[model samples]
Target chain A: MSENKRTEVDQLGEFGLIERITKDVEINHKSTVKGIGDDAAVIDCGDDYMVVSTDMLLEGIHFDLSFMPLQHLGYKAIAVNVSDIAAMNALPEQVTVSIAITNRFSVEAIDMIYQGIKAACKNYNVDLVGGDTTSSRSGLVISVSVTGRVAKDKIVYRSGAKKGDILCLSGDIGGAYMGLQVLLREKKVYESNPEMQPKLDDYEYIVGRQLRPEARTDVIHDLREIGIVPTSMIDVSDGVASEIMHICKASGVGAAIYEQKLPVDQRTFDACHEFKIPSVTPGLNGGEDYELLFTIDQEDFKKVEKNPNIYFIGYIDEAESGARMVTVGDQIVPISAQGFKHF
Target chain B: MSENKRTEVDQLGEFGLIERITKDVEINHKSTVKGIGDDAAVIDCGDDYMVVSTDMLLEGIHFDLSFMPLQHLGYKAIAVNVSDIAAMNALPEQVTVSIAITNRFSVEAIDMIYQGIKAACKNYNVDLVGGDTTSSRSGLVISVSVTGRVAKDKIVYRSGAKKGDILCLSGDIGGAYMGLQVLLREKKVYESNPEMQPKLDDYEYIVGRQLRPEARTDVIHDLREIGIVPTSMIDVSDGVASEIMHICKASGVGAAIYEQKLPVDQRTFDACHEFKIPSVTPGLNGGEDYELLFTIDQEDFKKVEKNPNIYFIGYIDEAESGARMVTVGDQIVPISAQGFKHF
Candidate 1:
């Protein structure tokens, strides 16, 4: 119990800690085609590969129950896990949810959470196959594990991108970040004056974006329909810039994204202005968007060129070039990912 | 939020709550062969069936860190999930462990937990595939999801026992329950007087059972080697009486177990005597044993009859007979399952 060295967890960071824990892990199963360091692990299941991913959400760390409805929290739990599956170009088939709750929650509260879970299951066409529910000593803890399948040749990875591949983003970013700002502001106002009705009518879009973000399964479907699998794929759960760096590092390539091309919703921009936060900052650093960030070969761009939801932001480059962002004013700056400091 | 109804979760109980939440769930995937009702969810994996199970353990609710070592806690987490897989007569191939911790834990403490996890993974021959590590507001929470495979025909379910099947017990039971009692007593002593050393030397057997229960994979191996698949099977996680009821309900049959036939280690019996708790009570209701309970066709009993580690406890009966226990004094008593009430 008495060790001279005591290093804080924050010192290692999330990814670094993961690397340290998994460093010595050796895959003993032949069916395990891939393990760790990916959106989902791949297991060879004869005709196709089974993809597995798990996520744990703690109350105060992952969400604030004050503004986040139990139903939306439940839906987001499933959606976020499914986003991992979608990131691997897999179709989610089953999910297992495990929750630990304290007595402060009523049976009705649990039902509301399940309602949201069921809604997400229906929306994603995934089955709620199994789960565990237990009592917690404190706040709620929700952990979800999703299983998905992809054709052997169709699976995508963050390490698959090549130089000159066009970077594509599905839908706008920063909405969820702006939504969180609005929710926090409203919460503060409500705390200051309990009788005052919080103004939320105009911030509905951004707030909804934060509370009920959906997995970009539509983009996965669109790619499948067009028969063009992305060279590299990742879900933007940790913001665009961080995910871009992940793809670049894993693919041993470089990325150049245009700030002017970064998609931002009108409502999100307005909220960002009101909050006195730079709109682009949220787009680059705001998380929980659940959008798909991917790279496709330049030749295949024509197939999705007219798609309104897909935005071409930039292109891949040689590894020596490193990751950079071209500002709206035409100045290029090195892009550094400031991921969420949950620890 | 107020509908004039407030039913506490304790009223529904853990199993009842699970049934209530899963009552209206509809499975949408063809790959999902069995959902929500077995030791693990069964999925179609082409030539074989894949069984998946997940469990979550919170700090205070599941284990007290004051007496439970971090390493043993990590090992127990994986072992318990693997026990669910073993209950389905499957060999676990991979597991995903998601953990949430507060800043109170040092990096070294986290490593100790992972060290135990890695040890269990090595012992069980399962790979650590994927997991999520995040921050918690308070205590540590570990959620493990395991995937195992079994030949389609060899997969065992709790619903397969027929009348006259001989009930079999693997290794021993009630030891873990006694172990917990000893640990709690020692913890109380240590708390009151920090200078006092825990008198756990004589309680080693029971204490070890509580701290480091192993999944009965050896029993599964023996059964496979002997070419004898049980008619029905489940892990003795929630004590023998509760598991007996599960089998009877699922298989539409009743059971009759002999109290004298129940296996209790000498140390466990001694601890039970000292604590003044009936030895039979722990055998019937003491949980966390992690032993395999199964029913084999009467004809197959001869194969395991001479196996020293296996014990013949009882036999399956007609549904109309009802579940009962033949006491040591020859008096018959109806059995009731008082499972762990974590809720």
Candidate 2:
């Protein structure tokens, strides 16, 4: 009721706000094996552990509907949540989607969205178990919650990394971010001149990376096939730098990544050049990649060393060293998280 | 992209729309015991069954901040989701809450919401394990997903009722609906005259019903103590009439509720009279009661016949009879579901 002191949400940031909210929460249920802070919460089932995670996407902040097809939007919603489950080394079994839209959207529009949702459901082999659909006063809001399962011995967390573990990435980074830039530029051009046809053919790969991202469950399957379990794992949602910092803080270890080892597709690199931005900047700080950033034991590195899809980027180190990156010119600099600022 | 045939969502209604969306879904997991068309999705958890449900609430549609305090709003959101778990005769173990808010909210305001959420977590014995926090372009949106567990034999669904079963009510109904009316009236008064303070003391009982309704977990415990497993069950979220119709349709039976047997709080009855609305209207169609409506075999009725909180309001009949209500004047009227129209 008092207006004397009002602190903006941006001041605390997303993580800061989450920490404040979870600080006082007490776990009363014995079945809750893990709570808060992890990619997903782990619950004790009879034969295995259940992993649950949820994410909320808002219009304007998370996506621009102007250039985004409803079908891709629906598919991306499921993929993002599934990526969280994949981060825990778990197989997602079910997902619940809740969407709020205004009357401006027609029933046909909703069907297109579901067409994409059903496609993702089949692709990931996860059932559309339950959801809630309601009306919103303004823009669209999509919230998805997914549940997954993993063997008790195979469950992984962000706190499992060791000092000598090898850090690896599932796929290339920054393509999604570069794709967004291209789309925004094209949108501006189309808005300024109605007759201008958007030139997007050359940027197809990057645009597809942004419009439709995959969860990397295949990579999880590959690791299982090779008899390797990630020591620590996290989804590369908020870029490699921010995710690395999270792994470091949770595992109580530092990391040193090499700039040259970072994976950036050729198309993404060219787009970066055209946009007048450094490729490494987008690779390190661009969010929404939905790739997996994980660390495996050094002894198991030989098993996946030759894998084409997996790239070795860094190694875990003592906590005192902090998280840093070595430049191409032999300069060492501390990594700062400049991820997406929703506020 | 053709605008020739745009169908309004309100035409299909919420249930119709859900049916349209879920009609083509294919269940791909053996662990999924039940999907959609239930209070929650039931999944096989080896020794037991896990039930999952999700609900979304938006500002201006679900609640108005003018009369609905943020603390109570947070508490109600969790309670409503937990009620769905209770509907399936399960014990909730964990919940994930995802919220999106605009910059208009302050740190203190967020803390208040979390305080209420934590309080509900303690009361329900459920853990706040995971959640997502992000910025919204407009009003606040809260989406809560809850997972609960029940013994495989005790898991109840809406499709298990049989002819000659007795219909039972967990507690008083129509209070929450009347409560909303009182709040809306008081809100309008305050809006017209800014200096007018809301006179809510006399209507505290009903107003609290709207703002802080509790899930009927107590009733579930009572049923368990008496060795009773409801043949069919549902939460009284969308009024008694809508829920009964759901049970009849799912179970392939008919039900006849007695108007005189409907339970109403004295305060709610008095308020309804003052508002010049029939008491039966809110009792039969008023929603958000969060009470459990269930059916039991007539042979098992004696076990809970004397329970104080349980009221016997109706009986199951042959499907050909159709769902109806017997008025106090000895007239029978068919029931229609004019439930909450969020669209």
Candidate 3:
């Protein structure tokens, strides 16, 4: 720590910080097929390639308990990590969940959280393996790491796409972001008027998206069954824009996504309109979607072209072209990431 | 969740809490051979078994950053998780670390912590495969999970011990606890007078023991090399007394540990004496020893009898006899566990 070299994390942003931090990391093990720059790290474990990914959720920083139920919070933690494994086109086999809670939580409260965790495990067919439960000085903290397995040939990474690949997205986006908007608005309303009930009935779909987002494991299975191999893949965690940028930088190819092709749910668009937020903004940069963003060879495009669930939104191009979006007015514009900032 | 049946975690203690929490857990995956009740969960990955263990370190709850360096905290976090794998008689191959830090932490501070993590991974020959870094609302929190592998025949569990098995403890104990006392004392002295240079030179070994403890993986390697298998094993993260109780309960046996045979470092003994704490109490009840406690077949005792690092402290007996200890003064006392309570 030199006195003159204090680098603020904000100046570098999350991606920049990760780049600086992982720059010197060396993979010494023969089994470690991949280290960073992927949805999950890949390890060659004899018969199968093990995929490992981790996620940490912090109170206040990541979620507000006033809007987030403990059970949903627990499920979301597991889902997010599982989503990472799904991005690698792997089947999640085991997960470890570590939580730190303050004394304000009772034994029953903890059990409620575990109940959701157990439910998620059963739903995803993953075994809850090992973890640490400890006391926290302040708020709740949950960190979950999941391990999955895939055949060596089936594994996908963020750095495998080439120029002329088609960018595909699994399912819709912006619902979770819109759901967060509704929750925050309701919270503010409730805070001001203690007697009022949150009007969540009308926004159930979007709210559900925020509270209980499922990992795109189904899409991974579908891809496998359809015999489609993703050239490059990542989860839409930070946002479509940021994640596409990640794919572009890692795969050394630019992408041109069409804004008109973006799949924003009806409820999501209505919620955005109701909240006075730009309709396209939520789909483009609002995060926590957990959808799969992948690139496929142009030859295999026809296989998924008619699939209702799969949306073709972009095409890979030369690196010098940069990541951009083709708008409805037939104008091409550069895509700049405005993902959630914690700092 | 019934209102009439509120179970407090403190009443159950840590192990009791664990048992209560995991009692109803159902393993849904055929790959998951073992979920809980061991140092690491075992998943049958076709040709080999993958063992996973997780550990969490919280600020104030786990350690005081005033005297503990970020690097040592990082090192200890990895070492503790590795110790769990060693307890399973497995070799750690990969690790995922998740960290939450407030903006108060500079990139340099985070780098120091990662430096320690990197050093530990290098020392243990494990790959730093994946991790998550996020902003924390309060203090720094680090959670690490390691995956290891062991032969099916050689994997040790806590329920495998038989009556008359010789109990062995690796290396010395109580040094970490004594080191903590010294650090606390220095902190108090520094608090009282800002300009005072609190003495720490003489207590280097004990203080180092508290700040940075190594896992007893060497003992595991030695035992494997000697073709001696521990019937039951656990890491002494809690006090030796508490861990022995766990082994006895799991194995359905009684233990007779001799007080005179307990291993204690000279510096630890001196520190205990200086602090006017019972010398035997520190050796038996002090936590963070990071030593391996195991029971071996009596036939295998001769192989380790000449080993300097291994100390034969007791023997297993029938369950009806209960866990008891023979004092140096020739008094037979029933064993009591006053384990470290993180809550």
Cα-based lDDT for every prediction: 0.93, 0.93, 0.88
Q: Whole-model lDDT, candidate 1? A: 0.93
Model 1 agreement with the true structure over A48-140: per-residue lDDT tens digits: 999999999999988999989999999999999999999999999999999999998888889889999999999999999999999898899
User: In model 3 chain B, which range of ten residues has the least summed lDDT?
Assistant: B1-10
lDDT tens digits by residue: candidate 3, A1-343:
4755887888887777777778888788787899877889988777789898998889998888898888898899899999999999999999988888887777888888898898899889898887888888999988898989899899999999899999999979999888888898899999999899999999999999989999999998999999998999999988899899989989998999998999999999899888899878889888889999999999998898889999999899999999999999989999887775531
lDDT of 1 by residue, B125-231 (tens): 99999999998889999999999999999999999999999999997889998888888888889999999999999998999998899998888888999999999
lDDT of 3 at B323: 84
Report fnat for all candidates as fractions from 0 to 1.
0.87, 0.86, 0.68
The DockQ values of the predictions, listed in order, are 0.87, 0.82, 0.69
- Give the runs in model 1 whose Cα sits over 4 Å from its true position: B1-4
Residue runs of model 3 more than 4 Å from their true location after superposition: B1-8
Give me the TM-scores of chain B across the candidates.
0.98, 0.98, 0.96
- Model 3 iRMS: 1.6
Docking quality tier of model 3: medium
- The deviation in Å at residue A13 for candidate 3 is 1.9
